[model samples]
Target: MRTVGHLLSRPVAIGTALVLVMLIAGFVGWRLTGGGEYVAPTPSAAPTVRADTVAGRDSLEELVAGVRDGAKPEGKGAAAVATRNADAIGIEGLSARYVAESGNVDEDGSWTADVDMSWRAPGDPTLSEELKVGFDGDGEITGFSADEGTRMPLWLSGPVEVRRTGSTLVVVQASAEQADRYAELAASAVKQVRTVIGWDRPRLVLEVPASGLDSALGAQPSTYSSVAAVTATVDGSSTAGSPLHVWVNQDVIGDLDSPGAQVVITHEAVHAATAAPTNPHRPMWLVEGYADYVALRDTTLPLSKTAGQILAQVREDGPPKHLPGKAEFNTRSEHFGAEYEAAWLACVVLAEAGGQEALVDLYEQTGRGVPLERALRASFGFGVDELTARWRTHLSDSAR
Candidate 1:
C-alpha cells in the first residue's frame, strides 16, 4: 500500500496523533448481564424507584424541586447533587450507588459511566463495587448513579469487535479471558442506545480486517469521510440495513493517545448501533446533531470556541437561512468548530426542555424512522423554522 503522506497536515496530524495517544487507554467498559431476571412478588408487580423518607428533608426537597423546576445547582457532582436533591425531595434510601470502578475522566474533568451496574445496591454487597452518576447542565441527575459497594462479577473480555453480519449486526473480539468483557461492552453500548430509542442489537462479527476498506465495511462506505484510524459516513434515507459503520485502526490497537478518541469511537458506535426500521433520512443538523450529542454530551470539548463562532456568524449574517446550505457550512464549518458543538447543544436544549427521553424521541424522528421536519416538531414541540429561531436565541445566551 502506498503512503498518503501528502494528505497529512501538521495540525491534522497532531489531532490524529492525539487519537493515537488515546488508544493506550485500552477498552474500559462494564455491563449488567444475566441475573436470571428480577422475580416479581406477583406477575403484574413492578418495583418502583423509591424515595420515601427525608431527615435532612426540608433542604434536600427544596434542592430537587429547584432542579426539576430548572434551577442550576451550585456544584458539578451529579451524585452529590442527586443525594442532596433526593434528600430535599424526601425520598428514602436515595443513596447514590458507588461501585468501585475507576472511570476515564474526559478533558473537561468529567467521568463517563463505564461500570458494571449489577454491582449496585440491594443485591450481593459482598461482591459489590463503587459507582458514579451523571448530571445535566442545571445539575439534575439525568442518568444512573453508582454506590460504593455494588458487587458484580466479570462478564466478557476480548478485542471487542462490532460489525454487520448479513442483516444482523455483531460485536465480538477479545481474548479468551476477555470474551465476557467484550460481549458486555458491545451489549451495554447497544442497550444504552436502545434505552431511549428503540432498536435491536445486531449480530456480532469478530475478525480483524486485513484487506481493503470494503472488507472492513462488510458493506459499502457512505458519503462521509473514511480515513486512517477513522471511517465515518452519512447514509441517506434508506433502511436496507444499518446506516453507520465503525472500526478501530488495527495498527493503533490497545492505545489511548487522545482522550477524545474514546469519545469519538463511542459516538460512532452509537450511530452504528441505532438502526431503526424506517428510511434513513435525517437532516445534516439532526444527523450530526445526534452524533455530536453522543460525541460531546456529558463529556467536554472546547464548546466556548464554538459558541463564540456561532455568535460571530449570527451577528454577521443572522441565524442561518433555515438549515443553511451544506456547501456554505462545509466551507467554513471548522471556522465555527461548534457546528458539532452547536448541534449537540441544540439537542440537549430540546431534550431538557422536553425530557431526557426526548433525545431518543428526536433521534427516532430525525433518524431513519420519521421525517426530519416532522421529527423536529414532534420532539421539540416546534417546527424547523421555530427551532432555528430558538437555536439562534440559545447561541446568543451561550455567548454571554
Candidate 2:
C-alpha cells in the first residue's frame, strides 16, 4: 500500500525513537520516516535578473527545441555535447527554465546555460530536475548533463557505496563495515519476505544523512525519523513500469543483528515485493497489519514486548471503539505504534480463525479492489462489524 507518488508532509519527532523500536516489526504502508517536528527553513530572496541572462533564457529554450528536434549542435565542448544528448534522451516531461548565475558565453563562440526544470503531471507528485545545456553560441549545442532530481542524492554524488546481497542490491551511505552489515540484513529481509509472501527481491537504498534521505524521498520532510524505512515508487510516477526504491535510515537501523531490525527489514521487503503503480483502496490496517504478521511470523519475540504499548493503552481505556484508520497510522499521530500493534493483532486473529491462506486470500481480494465487507464475508464468513467485535474481544482477553 506504499505508493511512491504520495509525499508525507508531517515531520517525525525525534523523541519517538522508543516507540519506533517496539513498532519497527511492522510496516506503515507508506514512505514514512521518524524525525523531529519539522520547522521549514527560511527562504532566501530571489536575485535580480540581468539583460544578458534574459537573452540566455531564450537561447536555452532554443537549445531545448533543437534537442527535441534531434538537431545536433556544431561544437566540440564536452559539457555542451553532454547537455544536448541529455535533452535528446528526454526530461521525463519536465519544462526547463534558465538560471542567471549558471549561464556563461565562452570566447570561442561556445556557451553553457544552467536551467532548473520541474514536472507535475495530473494526479502525480511534483518534482524538479537540473539541466545544463552547452551550445556553440551560434545556436548549435556543444555538451551537457541533466540531473534527474528524483534520484537518491548519495547515489548521485555522495559517499554511498554499493554491495550486492544475493539477488538484491544494497546501496548505503555509511561506513564500509556498516554497509556490509546492512547488506546482510537486507538479504535476510528478502529471504524472510519470500518465505512468507513469496515476493521477489527489491533494490534497497539506505542513507545516513537527513539531506540525502530527503533528496531520495523527493524532498518531503518527514517527522518519523524513528521509522526504520519506507518503500516508495520511482520518481513519484504511478506508471505500471515505474521502478521502486526502498529507502532506509541507517542511523535508525544500525543494529542489524537485533530482532527489531530484522523485523523492520522484512516488513519493508514485503512492501517492496507487493508494490504496484496504484495500490488497491484496501483498509490501511490490513495493508500494514498483514505486513507485520509476516515480518514477525518466525520471530521469538513475546507479544508483550511487541504489543506492550497497545495492551497498556487498552487496559487503561478498554478496546478501541472502531478499527485504526489511515489517520491513526500517520507519523504525526501519538498512538502510531499502538495502531500498528492493534492492526497486527487483527491479522493474527484472522489467521487464527481461518488460517494463513484465508488471510492471504482476503488480502489479495481486497488488493484487487474488492470491498472490505464483501471480501470479509467471502474470506471469513463475517462482515466488518462482526470482525471488529471479534477482534475487540480477542484484544480484551489478550490484555488480561
Candidate 3:
C-alpha cells in the first residue's frame, strides 16, 4: 500500500483532487531538508588585502559623483539608517492591514526600509508571529515586506465587529442606518458593565422590531403586556423551553434616555448574559437586584448618590438585616425598587468593607450549593440580628 504522502506529493497525475495532501507532503519534505541546508563560507583568519589609499582616489571621486547623481549610499547597513528617521512617519490603525512598511534615513546618507506583516485573525486569543524585513542600499531602503501569503494559516478571517461604548453594545443592524447617539450610549454602558463584571465584547446583529421579536419567540397577542420589552413565556418551567422573550419597539429609536434603543439593547443583553445562567433556586432579590444594580451603577450619578437614598430608606423602615427573598420581592411590588437598591448597597458595602475578593467568595458560597443562612454566617460572622443592626447603623451614620 502506498503512503498518503507518497500518493499526494509524488507528481502522480493530472486532474487529481489531492492538492491539499500534496501541500502537506511538500511541507514535510521542506521541513526535513533544512531549507536546502544553507551554509555560510568561512572567513579567512589573516587579512590578505589592504586598501591603497592613494590609488583609489579617482574611484572614490567617481563614487561621490554617483552619490550626487541620486545613487544611495551602500554598505553602511539598513539598521543604522532606520534608527535616525524612524519617528518621521506614523500609521494610524495600521493593524487592520495584513502588510505594513516603514523606513528612515541615517546620518551617513543611507536609507532603511522596514516591512512587517501578520497572519492572525483580529479576535484570536493566541498571539500570532509578525514577520519583519529590513533593507538598506545607498543608505536608503528601496523595498521591504513580510512573506507573501503568510496569512493563509490564520484561524480567523474577518474584522472584529463588536465595539464597547459603555455598558451596552452598539450593534448596527443591517436593516437600519447607524444611529450615532445610540452607538455612543451603548458603548458607554458596556464599559460600565465590564467594570463590574468582565465580559467579552458584545455582538452586533441586525436590528429587529417588536413584531419581529414576537415572531421569533412565536408569542401570542394575549400572553404579555403591551410593553415592547416585556418578557413572554414559552413552556413549563421545569421542562426545557424558552423561559423569556423580549420585544423591541422600533418606533422610538431616536430616544437615548427614555425608551432609548441602546438602553433596551443593553437591558435585554444583561438579561441574557446574567439572568439566563442563574440557577432556578437563586433569589429574585439578588437576580433582579443585580440587574438593576448594574443599570443604576452605570448611570452618570456616583454610586453613593444614586443608591444611597433608597438604601437609607430601606434601612430605616425594613431593617436590611431581615433581607427578603425572591418570593417576597414580587409581593412588595410598591417597594421593589427600594429593595433592589438596598440589596445593591448592601453588596457594595460588603465589597468596600471586606474587599472584592471576600465579597466574591461570599457570592460563590451562597449562590446555590450552600444554604443561605450558612453562607451569610460564614461571610459576615454575624447572624441576622447583629449583621442587620450593624448595617442599619452604618447607613444611618453615613447619612448624618
Candidate 4:
C-alpha cells in the first residue's frame, strides 16, 4: 500500500480554535494510498520431495488436510495453530477455510505447507491467498510470514471485530462497539460520495487497526507513519475482480472528533468510489482535490476553518505557480496539508467556474485518457495555465 496511490489525510485530527487548521495539521503526515496495479507476493517454490509421514508418526496429509475446517485440535498441530490464528483475529462471524495445496517435511521433523487460506466476515466477501506456514519437530506450529507486496489482513495478523452497515463493511482491531462506530462512519462516507458520484455504487470497505506496525499491510513503517487511511489493492496482487480497499491507521485516525472523522472517511470514500488510484496518468491535484472537495462539500465550516493552510500560504507566499504534483506530495509527506488544501481549492475553482457537473465531467474525461488541457477547454472553456491563473487568484482572494 505504501507505493500505491495513497489518498486522504487527517483521520485522527483535532486541535486549536480553528478546526480546519488543526485538521490540516493532522493531515500533515500522509503517504498517499491507492494505485492502478500491484505486484503479487512471490510464493515460495513448493518442494517436490514429500513425505506422507513426519518422523514416521503423524501423517503429514492428515495434519495438512485438517486445516480445511480451520478447527483447533485437542492439543497441538498445524491445523490447530491456524485455527488459533483465526480465533485470535476476533472478528465476529469470521471463518477460515484452508486448502493444503503443497508441503514438505524437513530433516528435523519439521514441515512446511502452502495453504490456500480463505477467510470471510459477516457482510464482506471472502479473501483467499496462499501463505506458507510451518510446524516444528513436536507437532507445534513454528512460524508464518508474508514477504513484501502481500496484504496481511487482520484475520491473518491479530484480533479484530467486524460490523456491517448497508453496503459498507468495517473491520476494527478493537471492540465490537468500535466496529459499529466505524460502520456508521462508512455509511456516512457512502452517503456523501453518493451525493455527487451517483453514477456508480460505492463499495466501502475499511480496516481500522487500533495498534499494529504501519507495515502490517505490507508497507514500510516510515512510509505512512502519519497517513489517516489509504485506498489500495486488497491483496497486493491486482485483479479485475478484486479492485481496492481502504485502510485506516487507527493511531492516526483516532484523534478526530465526529465531524473530522466523517470528513476523513468520506474523503477516502470518494477515492474508493472514483477508483482514483487505478489511473496513474491523471493529475494528482484533480484526484486528491476532488476527494477533498466532496468531503468538504456539505460542511458549514467557513473557508478560514477548512482552508486555513493554503489561505495562509497565499497570504505569506502569494499563490503557487502551478498545481500540486506527485513530487509535492512525496517530498512534503510530513507537512503536505497545505498542498491538499490547495488541491481542494483548485477543484473548488472548477466547480465554481463550470458547476459541479462540469467538474465531474472534467475529472471523468481526464481519467479516460483525455488530456487535461483538452478536458479543461471542453468542460471549463480554459486550459491548464488559465485554470492555474484563476486558481492563483482564487487563493489570493480566499486569503483575504
Pick the lDDT winner: 4
| CA lDDT, every model vs. true structure | 0.44, 0.66, 0.42, 0.71
Alpha-carbon RMSD to native, per candidate: 30.5, 26.1, 23.8, 26.6
User: Candidate 4: worst 10 consecutive residues by lDDT?
Assistant: 2-11
Question: Comparing candidate 3 with candidate 4, which one achieves the higher lDDT?
Answer: 4
Model 1 weakest lDDT span, ten residues long: 151-160
lDDT of 3 by residue, 108-166 (tens): 33332222322211221222334333323332232232333232111111111223332
Instruction: Give a tens-digit lDDT track for model 2, residues 15-55.
Output: 36546644764444222665555588999976642334545
Best to worst by TM-score, what's the order?
Answer: 4, 2, 1, 3
Question: What stretches of model 2 exceed 4 Å from their correct place?
Answer: 1-99, 102-128, 131-152, 200-212, 220-222, 255-257
Better of 2 and 3 by lDDT: 2
Query: Model 1 over residues 161-279: C-alpha lDDT tens digits?
Result: 33332333333344434334333444444544555445554432222232223333333433112322232322222335533434444334334444344444545455665542233
Tens digits of per-residue lDDT, candidate 4, 1-400, equal: 5312222233333232256555666555332443435578899986564433343224334444454445556644434544554543333333223345244566666666555556554434566656655656565455555555455656555445667655777767787777888989999889888889873656788878666435557766466666778887665654434566788877777888888888889999988787777776579989999999999999998888788988887888889899989877773265467888899999999999999999999988987899999999999999999999999999988888
Q: TM-score: which candidate is best?
A: 4
TM-scores of all predicted structures? 0.41, 0.64, 0.40, 0.70
- Supply the TM-score for candidate 1: 0.41
